[model samples]
Target: MAEELRLFAGVDAGASRTALVLGDATGRILSRVRGGPGILRPGRAGAVAERIAGLLKQALGASGPVASLEALVIGAAGAGREAERGALEEELRRRVESRAVLVTTDAAVALQSAFPEGPGIVLSAGTGSIAIGRNREGTVYRVGGWGRQFGDEGSAYSLARAGLAAVAKAEDGRGPKTLLTARMLEAAGKVSVEELIAWARLARPQRVAALAPVVCRAAAEDPVASLLVQAAAAELAHHVEALRERLSDFAIPVALSGGLLVKGSAVRDALVARLKAAEPPVNLVDRGVDPASGALALALGLRP
Candidate 1:
Protein backbone atom coordinates (compact mmCIF):
# COMPACT_ATOMS: atom_id res chain seq x y z
CA MET A 1 0.00 0.00 0.00
CA ALA A 2 1.20 3.51 -0.70
CA GLU A 3 1.90 5.77 2.27
CA GLU A 4 -0.81 8.13 3.34
CA LEU A 5 -0.44 11.84 2.68
CA ARG A 6 -1.10 14.31 5.47
CA LEU A 7 -2.01 17.96 5.80
CA PHE A 8 -0.53 20.55 8.14
CA ALA A 9 -1.60 23.87 9.54
CA GLY A 10 0.54 26.76 10.72
CA VAL A 11 -0.29 29.86 12.68
CA ASP A 12 1.71 32.94 13.54
CA ALA A 13 -0.18 35.12 15.93
CA GLY A 14 0.99 38.49 17.14
CA ALA A 15 -0.33 41.29 19.26
CA SER A 16 -1.67 43.27 16.28
CA ARG A 17 -2.50 40.54 13.79
CA THR A 18 -2.47 36.83 13.02
CA ALA A 19 -1.68 34.70 9.97
CA LEU A 20 -2.61 31.12 9.25
CA VAL A 21 -1.39 28.94 6.41
CA LEU A 22 -2.29 25.43 5.41
CA GLY A 23 0.12 23.15 3.63
CA ASP A 24 0.12 19.64 2.23
CA ALA A 25 2.62 16.90 3.03
CA THR A 26 4.93 18.22 0.37
CA GLY A 27 5.09 21.69 1.99
CA ARG A 28 2.96 23.31 -0.67
CA ILE A 29 0.60 26.01 0.50
CA LEU A 30 -3.07 25.13 0.27
CA SER A 31 -4.78 28.03 1.94
CA ARG A 32 -3.79 31.16 3.84
CA VAL A 33 -5.61 33.79 5.84
CA ARG A 34 -4.71 36.91 7.81
CA GLY A 35 -6.73 38.50 10.58
CA GLY A 36 -6.65 40.77 13.57
CA PRO A 37 -4.61 40.25 16.74
CA GLY A 38 -4.50 36.77 18.35
CA ILE A 39 -2.81 37.32 21.69
CA LEU A 40 -5.18 37.08 24.57
CA ARG A 41 -4.33 40.17 26.54
CA PRO A 42 -5.43 40.36 30.18
CA GLY A 43 -9.08 40.92 29.38
CA ARG A 44 -9.15 39.97 25.72
CA ALA A 45 -8.36 36.26 25.76
CA GLY A 46 -11.86 35.09 24.99
CA ALA A 47 -12.29 37.54 22.18
CA VAL A 48 -8.92 36.66 20.72
CA ALA A 49 -9.67 32.95 20.84
CA GLU A 50 -12.97 33.57 19.13
CA ARG A 51 -11.25 35.46 16.39
CA ILE A 52 -8.65 32.75 15.90
CA ALA A 53 -11.28 30.07 15.68
CA GLY A 54 -13.22 32.15 13.23
CA LEU A 55 -10.19 32.72 11.04
CA LEU A 56 -9.41 29.02 10.99
CA LYS A 57 -12.89 28.12 9.80
CA GLN A 58 -12.90 30.93 7.32
CA ALA A 59 -9.55 29.85 5.93
CA LEU A 60 -10.65 26.25 5.69
CA GLY A 61 -13.77 27.40 3.87
CA ALA A 62 -15.60 24.08 3.70
CA SER A 63 -12.55 22.37 2.30
CA GLY A 64 -14.50 19.10 2.57
CA PRO A 65 -14.76 19.09 6.35
CA VAL A 66 -11.20 19.55 7.67
CA ALA A 67 -11.16 16.48 9.95
CA SER A 68 -8.17 15.09 8.08
CA LEU A 69 -5.84 17.65 9.66
CA GLU A 70 -2.80 15.68 10.86
CA ALA A 71 -1.03 18.22 13.01
CA LEU A 72 -1.13 21.84 14.06
CA VAL A 73 1.71 24.13 15.05
CA ILE A 74 1.08 27.60 16.37
CA GLY A 75 3.44 30.42 17.29
CA ALA A 76 1.69 32.98 19.39
CA ALA A 77 2.71 36.16 21.18
CA GLY A 78 2.17 34.86 24.73
CA ALA A 79 2.45 31.13 24.02
CA GLY A 80 6.03 30.76 25.21
CA ARG A 81 5.20 29.96 28.81
CA GLU A 82 3.25 27.09 30.32
CA ALA A 83 0.27 29.11 31.44
CA GLU A 84 -0.44 30.76 28.13
CA ARG A 85 0.47 27.65 26.19
CA GLY A 86 -1.94 25.55 28.16
CA ALA A 87 -4.77 27.97 27.54
CA LEU A 88 -4.09 28.16 23.84
CA GLU A 89 -3.71 24.42 23.42
CA GLU A 90 -7.01 23.79 25.14
CA GLU A 91 -8.71 26.37 23.01
CA LEU A 92 -7.32 24.87 19.83
CA ARG A 93 -8.15 21.35 20.90
CA ARG A 94 -11.68 22.43 21.52
CA ARG A 95 -12.04 23.95 18.08
CA VAL A 96 -10.42 21.31 15.88
CA GLU A 97 -9.71 17.61 15.80
CA SER A 98 -6.11 16.94 15.03
CA ARG A 99 -3.83 13.99 15.73
CA ALA A 100 -1.39 16.33 17.47
CA VAL A 101 -1.12 19.98 18.36
CA LEU A 102 1.87 22.07 19.37
CA VAL A 103 1.85 25.58 20.67
CA THR A 104 5.11 27.45 21.06
CA THR A 105 6.19 30.96 21.79
CA ASP A 106 6.13 33.21 18.76
CA ALA A 107 9.89 33.54 19.02
CA ALA A 108 10.31 29.78 18.90
CA VAL A 109 8.39 29.46 15.65
CA ALA A 110 10.15 32.53 14.26
CA LEU A 111 13.48 30.88 14.99
CA GLN A 112 12.23 27.65 13.46
CA SER A 113 11.18 29.53 10.34
CA ALA A 114 14.62 31.09 10.13
CA PHE A 115 16.49 27.88 10.91
CA PRO A 116 14.74 24.66 10.10
CA GLU A 117 17.26 22.65 12.12
CA GLY A 118 16.76 25.18 14.94
CA PRO A 119 20.14 26.86 15.41
CA GLY A 120 20.13 30.58 14.89
CA ILE A 121 18.96 33.90 16.23
CA VAL A 122 15.60 35.50 15.41
CA LEU A 123 14.50 38.95 16.44
CA SER A 124 10.75 39.63 16.23
CA ALA A 125 9.92 43.31 16.65
CA GLY A 126 6.35 43.99 15.76
CA THR A 127 4.21 45.42 18.56
CA GLY A 128 6.85 44.11 20.97
CA SER A 129 10.28 42.51 20.74
CA ILE A 130 11.98 39.20 21.53
CA ALA A 131 15.36 37.66 20.69
CA ILE A 132 15.70 33.88 20.55
CA GLY A 133 18.50 31.71 19.22
CA ARG A 134 19.40 28.08 19.09
CA ASN A 135 22.99 26.90 19.10
CA ARG A 136 24.35 24.33 16.67
CA GLU A 137 24.24 21.87 19.55
CA GLY A 138 20.49 22.42 19.94
CA THR A 139 20.73 24.67 22.98
CA VAL A 140 18.44 27.69 23.03
CA TYR A 141 19.13 31.14 24.43
CA ARG A 142 16.49 33.82 24.74
CA VAL A 143 16.72 37.45 25.68
CA GLY A 144 14.29 40.35 26.05
CA GLY A 145 10.88 38.65 25.89
CA TRP A 146 9.56 40.82 28.69
CA GLY A 147 6.49 42.84 27.87
CA ARG A 148 6.51 46.48 26.78
CA GLN A 149 6.84 48.14 30.20
CA PHE A 150 9.64 45.91 31.44
CA GLY A 151 11.75 45.41 28.30
CA ASP A 152 10.85 44.67 24.66
CA GLU A 153 14.07 46.32 23.59
CA GLY A 154 14.29 47.45 19.95
CA SER A 155 10.58 46.87 19.42
CA ALA A 156 7.95 49.08 17.90
CA TYR A 157 6.98 49.88 21.48
CA SER A 158 10.57 50.78 22.19
CA LEU A 159 10.75 53.06 19.15
CA ALA A 160 7.51 54.71 20.10
CA ARG A 161 8.77 55.15 23.61
CA ALA A 162 11.90 56.72 22.22
CA GLY A 163 9.68 59.05 20.23
CA LEU A 164 7.90 60.06 23.40
CA ALA A 165 11.24 60.69 25.03
CA ALA A 166 12.26 62.85 22.10
CA VAL A 167 9.06 64.78 22.41
CA ALA A 168 9.77 65.32 26.06
CA LYS A 169 13.33 66.39 25.49
CA ALA A 170 12.20 68.86 22.87
CA GLU A 171 9.58 70.29 25.26
CA ASP A 172 12.09 70.49 28.12
CA GLY A 173 14.86 71.95 25.94
CA ARG A 174 17.20 69.29 27.19
CA GLY A 175 18.08 67.75 23.79
CA PRO A 176 17.88 68.15 20.05
CA LYS A 177 14.37 68.83 18.70
CA THR A 178 12.68 66.54 16.20
CA LEU A 179 9.92 66.37 13.66
CA LEU A 180 8.78 63.26 15.60
CA THR A 181 7.35 65.57 18.21
CA ALA A 182 5.10 67.31 15.71
CA ARG A 183 4.14 64.05 14.02
CA MET A 184 3.24 62.54 17.33
CA LEU A 185 1.32 65.64 18.24
CA GLU A 186 -0.48 65.36 14.94
CA ALA A 187 -1.23 61.71 15.68
CA ALA A 188 -2.76 62.65 19.00
CA GLY A 189 -4.31 65.88 17.75
CA LYS A 190 -3.92 67.15 21.26
CA VAL A 191 -3.88 70.83 21.87
CA SER A 192 -1.07 70.65 24.36
CA VAL A 193 1.61 68.27 25.65
CA GLU A 194 -0.27 67.79 28.89
CA GLU A 195 -3.28 66.48 27.04
CA LEU A 196 -1.07 64.15 25.05
CA ILE A 197 0.36 62.76 28.24
CA ALA A 198 -3.10 62.33 29.68
CA TRP A 199 -4.32 60.57 26.58
CA ALA A 200 -1.37 58.20 26.56
CA ARG A 201 -1.81 57.38 30.20
CA LEU A 202 -5.18 55.87 29.37
CA ALA A 203 -4.01 54.15 26.20
CA ARG A 204 -2.80 50.60 25.65
CA PRO A 205 0.91 49.96 25.12
CA GLN A 206 0.25 48.49 21.67
CA ARG A 207 -1.69 51.64 20.85
CA VAL A 208 1.47 53.57 21.67
CA ALA A 209 3.50 51.24 19.45
CA ALA A 210 1.21 51.98 16.51
CA LEU A 211 3.05 55.27 16.15
CA ALA A 212 6.45 53.70 15.51
CA PRO A 213 6.24 54.35 11.76
CA VAL A 214 5.80 58.03 12.38
CA VAL A 215 9.04 58.02 14.31
CA CYS A 216 10.79 55.99 11.62
CA ARG A 217 9.62 58.39 8.90
CA ALA A 218 10.62 61.36 11.01
CA ALA A 219 14.02 59.75 11.51
CA ALA A 220 14.63 60.10 7.79
CA GLU A 221 14.80 63.90 8.19
CA ASP A 222 14.90 64.62 11.92
CA PRO A 223 18.22 64.21 13.66
CA VAL A 224 16.71 63.04 16.93
CA ALA A 225 14.48 60.54 15.20
CA SER A 226 17.41 59.38 13.12
CA LEU A 227 19.44 58.82 16.25
CA LEU A 228 16.61 56.80 17.72
CA VAL A 229 16.40 54.53 14.66
CA GLN A 230 20.16 54.00 14.53
CA ALA A 231 20.20 53.37 18.25
CA ALA A 232 17.45 50.75 17.98
CA ALA A 233 19.23 48.98 15.14
CA ALA A 234 22.41 49.01 17.17
CA GLU A 235 20.59 47.67 20.18
CA LEU A 236 19.08 44.85 18.12
CA ALA A 237 22.55 44.07 16.80
CA HIS A 238 23.84 43.99 20.34
CA HIS A 239 21.19 41.42 21.27
CA VAL A 240 22.05 39.32 18.22
CA GLU A 241 25.73 39.52 19.08
CA ALA A 242 25.02 38.55 22.65
CA LEU A 243 23.14 35.48 21.46
CA ARG A 244 26.05 34.70 19.15
CA GLU A 245 28.48 34.86 22.07
CA ARG A 246 26.33 32.84 24.41
CA LEU A 247 25.82 30.18 21.76
CA SER A 248 29.40 30.55 20.47
CA ASP A 249 28.13 29.95 16.96
CA PHE A 250 29.55 32.62 14.71
CA ALA A 251 28.10 31.03 11.61
CA ILE A 252 24.56 30.96 12.95
CA PRO A 253 22.07 32.73 10.71
CA VAL A 254 20.04 35.67 11.96
CA ALA A 255 16.55 36.29 10.66
CA LEU A 256 14.50 39.45 11.17
CA SER A 257 10.71 39.37 11.20
CA GLY A 258 7.72 41.48 12.26
CA GLY A 259 5.84 44.44 10.83
CA LEU A 260 8.60 46.95 11.51
CA LEU A 261 11.07 44.91 9.49
CA VAL A 262 8.58 44.58 6.63
CA LYS A 263 6.87 47.21 4.49
CA GLY A 264 8.38 50.68 4.72
CA SER A 265 11.01 49.24 7.01
CA ALA A 266 13.48 51.84 8.19
CA VAL A 267 15.98 49.78 10.18
CA ARG A 268 16.32 46.57 8.15
CA ASP A 269 19.23 47.92 6.10
CA ALA A 270 21.00 49.31 9.13
CA LEU A 271 20.49 46.09 11.05
CA VAL A 272 21.94 44.00 8.23
CA ALA A 273 24.92 46.33 7.96
CA ARG A 274 25.65 46.12 11.68
CA LEU A 275 25.40 42.31 11.65
CA LYS A 276 27.80 42.04 8.72
CA ALA A 277 30.28 44.21 10.62
CA ALA A 278 30.30 41.84 13.58
CA GLU A 279 33.53 40.14 14.67
CA PRO A 280 32.75 37.26 12.34
CA PRO A 281 30.24 38.44 9.80
CA VAL A 282 26.84 37.05 10.81
CA ASN A 283 24.77 35.59 7.99
CA LEU A 284 21.58 37.62 7.67
CA VAL A 285 18.50 36.26 5.91
CA ASP A 286 15.87 38.71 4.70
CA ARG A 287 13.49 36.42 2.81
CA GLY A 288 10.62 38.02 4.78
CA VAL A 289 8.50 34.83 4.85
CA ASP A 290 5.76 34.84 7.46
CA PRO A 291 6.47 32.84 10.61
CA ALA A 292 3.35 30.79 9.91
CA SER A 293 5.44 28.95 7.38
CA GLY A 294 7.50 27.66 10.27
CA ALA A 295 4.43 26.39 12.01
CA LEU A 296 3.34 24.66 8.84
CA ALA A 297 6.77 23.11 8.59
CA LEU A 298 6.39 21.74 12.09
CA ALA A 299 2.91 20.48 11.47
CA LEU A 300 3.90 18.61 8.35
CA GLY A 301 6.45 16.67 10.34
CA LEU A 302 3.70 15.21 12.49
CA ARG A 303 2.07 13.32 9.66
CA PRO A 304 2.55 9.67 8.55
Candidate 2:
Protein backbone atom coordinates (compact mmCIF):
# COMPACT_ATOMS: atom_id res chain seq x y z
CA MET A 1 0.00 0.00 0.00
CA ALA A 2 1.19 3.52 -0.73
CA GLU A 3 2.66 4.94 2.46
CA GLU A 4 -0.51 6.22 4.08
CA LEU A 5 -0.91 9.74 2.74
CA ARG A 6 0.79 11.94 5.29
CA LEU A 7 -1.39 14.56 6.91
CA PHE A 8 -0.43 18.21 7.30
CA ALA A 9 -2.22 21.08 9.02
CA GLY A 10 -2.31 24.87 8.78
CA VAL A 11 -3.80 27.51 11.00
CA ASP A 12 -4.44 31.22 10.48
CA ALA A 13 -4.67 32.47 14.02
CA GLY A 14 -6.22 35.90 13.86
CA ALA A 15 -7.13 38.28 16.65
CA SER A 16 -10.88 37.70 16.41
CA ARG A 17 -10.92 34.22 14.92
CA THR A 18 -8.75 31.32 13.83
CA ALA A 19 -8.98 29.18 10.66
CA LEU A 20 -7.62 25.67 10.46
CA VAL A 21 -7.20 23.34 7.49
CA LEU A 22 -5.95 19.79 7.17
CA GLY A 23 -4.56 18.30 4.02
CA ASP A 24 -2.56 15.43 2.61
CA ALA A 25 1.05 15.60 1.46
CA THR A 26 -0.37 16.07 -2.02
CA GLY A 27 -1.96 19.33 -0.85
CA ARG A 28 -5.51 18.11 -1.32
CA ILE A 29 -7.38 19.87 1.46
CA LEU A 30 -9.21 17.38 3.67
CA SER A 31 -10.93 19.46 6.32
CA ARG A 32 -11.62 23.08 7.25
CA VAL A 33 -12.50 24.32 10.72
CA ARG A 34 -12.93 27.70 12.41
CA GLY A 35 -12.61 28.47 16.09
CA GLY A 36 -12.36 31.34 18.54
CA PRO A 37 -9.72 34.05 18.67
CA GLY A 38 -6.10 32.94 18.48
CA ILE A 39 -4.38 36.14 19.52
CA LEU A 40 -0.92 35.61 21.04
CA ARG A 41 -0.97 38.02 23.90
CA PRO A 42 2.21 38.65 25.91
CA GLY A 43 1.31 36.44 28.85
CA ARG A 44 -1.42 34.35 27.32
CA ALA A 45 0.63 32.19 25.00
CA GLY A 46 -0.33 28.99 26.75
CA ALA A 47 -4.04 29.60 26.39
CA VAL A 48 -3.71 30.46 22.72
CA ALA A 49 -1.47 27.46 22.20
CA GLU A 50 -4.12 25.25 23.75
CA ARG A 51 -6.68 26.70 21.37
CA ILE A 52 -4.48 25.82 18.39
CA ALA A 53 -4.18 22.19 19.45
CA GLY A 54 -7.91 22.14 20.00
CA LEU A 55 -8.39 23.30 16.43
CA LEU A 56 -6.28 20.42 15.21
CA LYS A 57 -8.18 17.87 17.22
CA GLN A 58 -11.44 19.25 15.89
CA ALA A 59 -10.17 19.12 12.30
CA LEU A 60 -9.19 15.49 12.89
CA GLY A 61 -12.84 14.74 13.75
CA ALA A 62 -11.78 13.33 17.14
CA SER A 63 -10.57 10.21 15.40
CA GLY A 64 -6.80 10.42 15.05
CA PRO A 65 -4.29 11.53 17.62
CA VAL A 66 -2.43 14.76 16.75
CA ALA A 67 0.78 12.69 16.46
CA SER A 68 -0.49 11.46 13.13
CA LEU A 69 -0.11 14.99 11.70
CA GLU A 70 3.09 15.33 9.71
CA ALA A 71 3.43 19.04 10.40
CA LEU A 72 1.62 22.19 11.44
CA VAL A 73 2.15 25.85 10.49
CA ILE A 74 0.38 28.72 12.22
CA GLY A 75 0.41 32.47 11.63
CA ALA A 76 -0.82 34.91 14.20
CA ALA A 77 -0.63 38.50 15.39
CA GLY A 78 1.78 39.27 18.30
CA ALA A 79 3.99 36.51 16.90
CA GLY A 80 6.36 38.72 14.92
CA ARG A 81 8.85 38.94 17.74
CA GLU A 82 11.20 36.08 18.50
CA ALA A 83 10.12 35.87 22.11
CA GLU A 84 6.46 35.76 21.23
CA ARG A 85 6.97 33.02 18.66
CA GLY A 86 9.18 31.12 21.06
CA ALA A 87 6.67 31.29 23.84
CA LEU A 88 3.80 30.05 21.73
CA GLU A 89 5.91 27.43 20.04
CA GLU A 90 7.16 26.07 23.34
CA GLU A 91 3.67 25.86 24.71
CA LEU A 92 2.28 24.26 21.59
CA ARG A 93 5.04 21.63 21.49
CA ARG A 94 3.98 20.41 24.92
CA ARG A 95 0.45 19.76 23.72
CA VAL A 96 1.06 18.56 20.16
CA GLU A 97 2.95 15.62 18.72
CA SER A 98 3.11 16.70 15.11
CA ARG A 99 6.47 16.00 13.50
CA ALA A 100 7.07 19.74 13.09
CA VAL A 101 5.46 23.00 14.09
CA LEU A 102 6.19 26.41 12.60
CA VAL A 103 5.11 29.71 14.07
CA THR A 104 5.10 32.97 12.07
CA THR A 105 3.40 36.32 11.90
CA ASP A 106 -0.06 36.87 10.53
CA ALA A 107 1.50 39.35 8.08
CA ALA A 108 4.05 36.83 6.84
CA VAL A 109 1.38 34.24 6.19
CA ALA A 110 -0.78 36.90 4.53
CA LEU A 111 2.00 37.76 2.09
CA GLN A 112 2.47 34.07 1.39
CA SER A 113 -1.28 33.71 1.17
CA ALA A 114 -1.38 36.35 -1.53
CA PHE A 115 1.85 35.71 -3.45
CA PRO A 116 2.76 32.16 -2.41
CA GLU A 117 6.19 31.50 -3.92
CA GLY A 118 6.29 34.79 -5.83
CA PRO A 119 7.31 38.22 -4.56
CA GLY A 120 4.51 40.67 -3.82
CA ILE A 121 3.07 43.03 -1.25
CA VAL A 122 -0.12 42.49 0.78
CA LEU A 123 -2.04 45.41 2.29
CA SER A 124 -4.35 44.33 5.12
CA ALA A 125 -7.01 46.68 6.47
CA GLY A 126 -9.32 45.27 9.08
CA THR A 127 -9.80 46.09 12.77
CA GLY A 128 -6.12 46.99 12.32
CA SER A 129 -4.16 47.84 9.16
CA ILE A 130 -0.74 46.63 7.99
CA ALA A 131 1.33 46.07 4.85
CA ILE A 132 3.93 43.31 4.42
CA GLY A 133 5.98 42.31 1.39
CA ARG A 134 8.51 39.81 0.13
CA ASN A 135 11.17 40.71 -2.46
CA ARG A 136 13.23 38.66 -4.88
CA GLU A 137 16.00 38.28 -2.31
CA GLY A 138 13.44 36.67 0.03
CA THR A 139 13.95 39.63 2.32
CA VAL A 140 10.62 40.42 3.97
CA TYR A 141 9.71 44.06 4.60
CA ARG A 142 6.86 45.65 6.50
CA VAL A 143 5.38 49.14 6.64
CA GLY A 144 2.53 49.46 9.15
CA GLY A 145 0.52 47.32 11.65
CA TRP A 146 1.50 49.31 14.74
CA GLY A 147 -1.89 48.73 16.37
CA ARG A 148 -4.54 51.32 17.31
CA GLN A 149 -2.87 53.41 20.00
CA PHE A 150 0.30 53.92 17.95
CA GLY A 151 -0.43 53.50 14.23
CA ASP A 152 -2.92 51.24 12.38
CA GLU A 153 -3.66 54.02 9.90
CA GLY A 154 -6.18 53.13 7.16
CA SER A 155 -7.70 50.57 9.50
CA ALA A 156 -11.34 50.50 10.48
CA TYR A 157 -10.24 51.42 13.99
CA SER A 158 -8.57 54.53 12.66
CA LEU A 159 -11.56 55.51 10.53
CA ALA A 160 -13.93 55.02 13.42
CA ARG A 161 -11.62 57.00 15.67
CA ALA A 162 -11.48 59.87 13.21
CA GLY A 163 -15.26 59.79 12.95
CA LEU A 164 -15.59 60.08 16.72
CA ALA A 165 -13.09 62.93 16.76
CA ALA A 166 -15.04 64.68 14.03
CA VAL A 167 -18.18 64.33 16.11
CA ALA A 168 -16.43 65.84 19.12
CA LYS A 169 -15.02 68.67 17.06
CA ALA A 170 -18.34 69.48 15.46
CA GLU A 171 -20.10 69.35 18.79
CA ASP A 172 -17.55 71.57 20.52
CA GLY A 173 -17.37 74.14 17.67
CA ARG A 174 -13.71 73.21 17.27
CA GLY A 175 -14.38 72.00 13.73
CA PRO A 176 -17.02 72.28 11.01
CA LYS A 177 -20.46 70.91 11.80
CA THR A 178 -21.29 67.72 9.89
CA LEU A 179 -23.59 64.71 9.79
CA LEU A 180 -21.12 62.55 11.72
CA THR A 181 -22.46 63.67 15.08
CA ALA A 182 -25.94 62.42 14.26
CA ARG A 183 -24.86 59.35 12.32
CA MET A 184 -22.22 58.20 14.76
CA LEU A 185 -24.66 58.46 17.61
CA GLU A 186 -27.18 56.45 15.61
CA ALA A 187 -24.60 53.80 14.74
CA ALA A 188 -23.59 53.46 18.37
CA GLY A 189 -27.26 53.19 19.25
CA LYS A 190 -26.96 56.02 21.68
CA VAL A 191 -29.40 58.86 21.87
CA SER A 192 -26.89 61.55 22.83
CA VAL A 193 -23.21 62.41 22.43
CA GLU A 194 -22.83 61.86 26.16
CA GLU A 195 -24.12 58.31 25.82
CA LEU A 196 -21.79 57.68 22.95
CA ILE A 197 -18.89 58.85 25.09
CA ALA A 198 -19.89 56.43 27.81
CA TRP A 199 -20.02 53.59 25.31
CA ALA A 200 -16.68 54.50 23.74
CA ARG A 201 -14.83 54.56 27.05
CA LEU A 202 -15.71 50.91 27.65
CA ALA A 203 -15.90 49.62 24.10
CA ARG A 204 -13.32 47.29 22.56
CA PRO A 205 -11.43 47.78 19.29
CA GLN A 206 -13.85 45.66 17.25
CA ARG A 207 -16.79 47.58 18.67
CA VAL A 208 -15.12 50.87 17.73
CA ALA A 209 -14.39 49.56 14.25
CA ALA A 210 -18.08 48.72 13.95
CA LEU A 211 -18.71 52.43 13.51
CA ALA A 212 -16.56 52.71 10.37
CA PRO A 213 -19.29 51.61 7.94
CA VAL A 214 -21.60 54.31 9.21
CA VAL A 215 -18.97 56.92 8.50
CA CYS A 216 -18.26 55.33 5.13
CA ARG A 217 -21.94 55.45 4.20
CA ALA A 218 -22.22 59.05 5.39
CA ALA A 219 -19.23 60.01 3.25
CA ALA A 220 -21.49 60.58 0.24
CA GLU A 221 -23.31 63.52 1.82
CA ASP A 222 -20.98 64.74 4.58
CA PRO A 223 -17.85 66.70 3.89
CA VAL A 224 -16.27 65.69 7.18
CA ALA A 225 -17.08 62.06 6.53
CA SER A 226 -15.77 62.38 3.01
CA LEU A 227 -12.51 63.83 4.26
CA LEU A 228 -12.19 61.03 6.77
CA VAL A 229 -12.69 58.42 4.05
CA GLN A 230 -10.16 60.12 1.75
CA ALA A 231 -7.61 60.39 4.50
CA ALA A 232 -8.10 56.72 5.33
CA ALA A 233 -7.52 55.76 1.70
CA ALA A 234 -4.49 58.01 1.59
CA GLU A 235 -3.15 56.32 4.71
CA LEU A 236 -3.67 52.86 3.19
CA ALA A 237 -1.99 54.03 0.00
CA HIS A 238 0.92 55.32 2.02
CA HIS A 239 1.22 51.86 3.58
CA VAL A 240 1.51 50.20 0.15
CA GLU A 241 3.78 52.89 -1.24
CA ALA A 242 6.07 52.69 1.75
CA LEU A 243 6.39 48.92 1.35
CA ARG A 244 6.97 49.35 -2.39
CA GLU A 245 9.85 51.70 -1.66
CA ARG A 246 11.61 49.12 0.52
CA LEU A 247 10.71 45.99 -1.48
CA SER A 248 12.34 47.04 -4.74
CA ASP A 249 13.42 49.96 -6.88
CA PHE A 250 11.08 48.69 -9.60
CA ALA A 251 7.36 47.95 -9.37
CA ILE A 252 6.07 44.81 -7.64
CA PRO A 253 2.66 43.19 -7.61
CA VAL A 254 0.48 44.40 -4.73
CA ALA A 255 -2.35 42.29 -3.36
CA LEU A 256 -5.15 43.75 -1.28
CA SER A 257 -6.23 41.48 1.61
CA GLY A 258 -8.35 41.79 4.76
CA GLY A 259 -11.99 42.32 5.58
CA LEU A 260 -12.09 45.96 4.51
CA LEU A 261 -11.19 45.59 0.84
CA VAL A 262 -14.56 44.27 -0.26
CA LYS A 263 -15.91 45.02 -3.74
CA GLY A 264 -17.14 48.58 -4.33
CA SER A 265 -15.68 49.64 -0.98
CA ALA A 266 -15.12 53.39 -0.86
CA VAL A 267 -11.81 52.88 0.89
CA ARG A 268 -10.83 50.14 -1.56
CA ASP A 269 -11.87 52.23 -4.59
CA ALA A 270 -10.13 55.34 -3.31
CA LEU A 271 -6.94 53.46 -2.48
CA VAL A 272 -6.99 51.78 -5.90
CA ALA A 273 -7.52 55.11 -7.63
CA ARG A 274 -4.63 56.71 -5.75
CA LEU A 275 -2.27 53.81 -6.42
CA LYS A 276 -3.33 53.76 -10.07
CA ALA A 277 -2.25 57.38 -10.32
CA ALA A 278 1.26 56.62 -9.08
CA GLU A 279 4.12 56.49 -11.57
CA PRO A 280 4.27 52.87 -12.93
CA PRO A 281 1.23 52.40 -10.71
CA VAL A 282 0.47 49.37 -8.59
CA ASN A 283 -0.31 46.01 -10.21
CA LEU A 284 -3.10 44.45 -8.16
CA VAL A 285 -4.30 40.85 -7.89
CA ASP A 286 -8.02 40.71 -8.67
CA ARG A 287 -8.73 37.36 -7.00
CA GLY A 288 -9.27 36.77 -3.31
CA VAL A 289 -6.22 36.00 -1.17
CA ASP A 290 -6.59 33.57 1.70
CA PRO A 291 -4.00 33.45 4.50
CA ALA A 292 -5.18 30.01 5.62
CA SER A 293 -4.09 28.64 2.27
CA GLY A 294 -0.76 30.35 2.73
CA ALA A 295 -0.27 28.61 6.06
CA LEU A 296 -1.21 25.38 4.38
CA ALA A 297 1.42 26.10 1.74
CA LEU A 298 4.02 26.49 4.45
CA ALA A 299 2.90 23.27 6.13
CA LEU A 300 3.35 21.48 2.83
CA GLY A 301 6.86 22.94 2.40
CA LEU A 302 5.76 24.64 -0.82
CA ARG A 303 6.84 28.18 0.04
CA PRO A 304 10.15 29.57 -1.12
Taking all chains together, each candidate's TM-score versus the true structure is: 0.89, 0.94
Q: Where does model 1 exceed 4 Å of error?
A: 1-5, 41-45
Give the candidate number with the greatest TM-score. 2
Clashing pairs in 1: none
**Model 2 score (lDDT):** 0.84
Tell me how many clashing residue pairs each candidate has: 0, 0
- The alpha-carbon deviation from the true structure for residue 41 of candidate 2, after best TM-score superposition, in angstroms, is 2.0
- Residue-level lDDT of model 1, residues 1-304, one tens digit each, is 1122466788988887889887777888878989987875454545656676777787677344555578888888876568777777777787777788888878887887878895778887888888899987899988877777777888988998888877877888997777877799899788776777678778887788888888888877888888888988887888888888898888888888887787567776677778888888988866555689988887887664
RMSD of each: 2.5, 2.0
lDDT of each: 0.79, 0.84
Q: Tens digit of lDDT per residue, candidate 2, span 84-123?
A: 8989989988998777888998888888878887678899
Superposition-based RMSD of candidate 2 using all C-alpha atoms, in angstroms? 2.0
